[model samples]
Target chain A: MKKLKRSARLVEMTQFLLARPHQLIPLTTFAQRYGAAKSSISEDLAIIKEVFEDEGTGELQTLAGAAGGVKYIPKMGREQALHFIEQLCEKLAEPNRILPGGYLYMSDLLGLPGLMNEAGKLFATAFAGRDIDCVMTVETKGIPLAYATGAELNLPVVLVRRDHQVTEGSAVSINYVSGSHKSLHTMSLSRRALKEKSKVLIVDDFMKAGGTIQGMVDLLAEFNAVVAGVGVLVESGEVETEQRLLRDYVSLATLRAVDAKGKEISVEPGNYFSRK
Target chain B: MKKLKRSARLVEMTQFLLARPHQLIPLTTFAQRYGAAKSSISEDLAIIKEVFEDEGTGELQTLAGAAGGVKYIPKMGREQALHFIEQLCEKLAEPNRILPGGYLYMSDLLGLPGLMNEAGKLFATAFAGRDIDCVMTVETKGIPLAYATGAELNLPVVLVRRDHQVTEGSAVSINYVSGSHKSLHTMSLSRRALKEKSKVLIVDDFMKAGGTIQGMVDLLAEFNAVVAGVGVLVESGEVETEQRLLRDYVSLATLRAVDAKGKEISVEPGNYFSRK
Candidate 1:
């Protein structure tokens, strides 16, 4: 923690804020870190703040009073987000991505850190000011997206397993029919994984009929948790148009139509922006 | 992008390097972005690079020549890595984490963005000069860890599935006994997941008797790929002492023994440092 010049300090501070988004860092902390006065730290933050907004990196919110400081809220520009989602739609429309049951193969996209981090930032932006305690998702594919959003929000991620694992200790398990398959599947969460009455934001890689989301909502009820928001990377508009399971959720992309036999499909940006 | 003051340019430059680790960013890009002379960008990078190294944030390698530029390699300082690993060992030793059959509950740990990022940086540091093409891991539990490391290394992640799915098109699957259970498990990588003769880094959440890691190594052989390195977050030392399937690997935490009946466990830092 040696003293750094103004240029070096600004560089380090930018990285510091970027690394711990949505968490407040008091001016005093930065002041102490650099052995500078509060006024100087404030000036440094001002420069960092302007550049962040200009580049659509995120937002820098400053609080007042004794506990006042700065908080970095990760945000993706609307145009950039739309562009990324449109690219995602193109990937989904690929013939090879079609599965046996009309599902899209997108685990590769979900597994990319850069893509997940971008999507996570968008989710964080959408759910900002909800006073979210943590982000939640089912195990497997959704875990990366959930973690990415949690990182952006500086919140923890809670995972609900497809099957109860002994390692998780005693847990709560609920059976619900999957949206696409209609087959009953059980999802469980450890008692310690989530606290009672917590405000949670749920995220997933894809949603078919919203059955999985509904199941999560039902499971949240058992712990007296509030579902502050639900976000999905892709939603099956085809299934929802026929029979919807849940409403009032945000989707970044929508699967408009699918032709499994001909391997023809169409995808478009979801209700994420339209809802706003 | 509008040209900015020296202060603003430094902030944007730092973020750009951080976002795309390991990719050589030409000096011309930054110079043009800011409309600044190459000399000024070099000066700004000097300040940023010094702070990055001083904070143990990462390494900034500046390459010379027509196609060369600067590359950011994510790295965690040794002290910080050790501290993080110690914290992990403590979390692992918690009584409630002990599950049936001596498995430790760690999905929560893997789900933490901050923790995973740190572990990813350490892994990136361990395999710094291996010329890795991608980070690889099996589906489900190991996805998050693999993605984390891939992010730090700025490489794509290749996922091996427990069961082959039609959506993946053609796949190469191999059955191998899990180290701890000795149960035969089939792991498959999509034909498109990796390239022939590519250098791969294999990562996992937990390793017991090194069976899963060995499975991945053998699986890589199917693609005619080379195993550049292997890393795990936690390893079962007791089981490994009894029978180890692989000897060359890096682990962050070592679960020495687990007393399921007594709910007491002995844990320590892994051979990560000793491997050096």
Candidate 2:
């Protein structure tokens, strides 16, 4: 790359940082790329850092010394996050989104990139400091949200399949009872998808009695991976507290009730808002 | 929102545009947000537009007059795309990635957000001008890639499941012959996942005999949707070309051969390089 003016460098640097979140970039790398001095690169990064924090887009952390450089940490302000969660609640409250089993048809919302990006950022902010080797989710709905969070954290996502596919090669399979109905369900992950003794963050779209999450946790046990943390987009508030399978997890929203006859639904921000 | 200075305004505006790719923003939105005049907003957009195009990040398109706002059309330069594809081919060529039945074990790469984001940008660039309302792919492996492409295109991703789930409500199921073996396969999409007569972009992680892509195209017919375009991350060249179920699709890489016995594989940039 040719040397660029400060203005152009700022723009390019911003793009570069935005593309790579939670990954450190040494100052010399930027200096060489822009054909500028390390001091000049540092100055540009300072400006970017200021703008990023001011806009509540993220944090640009500059580590000092030889092994240190700069890393972009994607974050959302409390006010903005609250607004986004409120918007999500509004969308979730829509009447047509209610399904027969009190399951709330949220695949549409889950599929929207805009919403997923917001959710991903929120999860990233919540788990920003954790040493997560990968984001794990069951196959299907949670994949997008997992990918979104992984994108923010610049980590790989591992999907736990409901049934093992031959294409995955050798795999680890486990059967567990689901929360909602106590039905026997099998979930599996390729042995190669995860490493032994790695730290993992588990995430899911919704939790009902925490059965599915427990299944994931049990599956992780087989991999010898530790659960760094767990995050859920929504946990069923209607489920009796005693029935909840996992208590040490973060949630973005709580589904209090769903009256199919009245076509009504109630949602509130999850523990994410209250947790420090 | 507080008014911003030009420097701050440029940074915020860039973030806004990048976050909402393919969506048009009226100039007045920026003017009001920054408490700046339309002319100043226009100038900021020009600077952003210049850098966006110059860096091959994307195209900043501006519409004139009342409803006019800048839109970010995510794109990857040919050089960058080639480099990315080559890197992907190298990864794919690894002997371990070759699975039984000539299947490429690409879920790991697909799960990596960094790789998926790049592939998303490449597909976004290839289909930037197409009239696409949403992206479609099968469940499991293709979900991340579909979401990645959808994220770049600023569209929703519709996942067609290999089997119908009760949670999805009413779904349209279609059975198609998959791959060279001509085995029977079934795929389904929720009735609400797509709208009638919408233009859809089909994407997948890998293509062998193009059966799955064709199945998605066939499934789209049930919804009265049109296949605007098809993109695969890798297409198997070892499969007899005549055995491919469909043509007229873009592939980022081509798997030339996979000699599982010798522990060697060959992969190259796909037709995406030749297509306009």
On residues B1-276, what C-alpha lDDT tens digit does candidate 1 reach at each position? Answer: 798889899999999999999899999999888999999999998999899999999999999989979999888888888888889898989888877787777867876888888888889989988888999988667777788899888888888888887767678999999877789989888887788999999999888888888989999999999999999988887873648988788999888989989999999999989987
Global lDDT scores for all candidate models: 0.87, 0.87
Stretches of candidate 2 exceeding 4 Å from the true structure: none
Q: C-alpha displacement of B89 in model 1, angstroms?
A: 1.9
Candidate 2 docking class: medium
iRMSD in angstroms, per model: 1.9, 1.4
Clashes of 1: 0
| DockQ result, candidate 2 | 0.69
lDDT of 2 at A239: 86
Residue B99 CA error for candidate 2 (Å)? 2.8
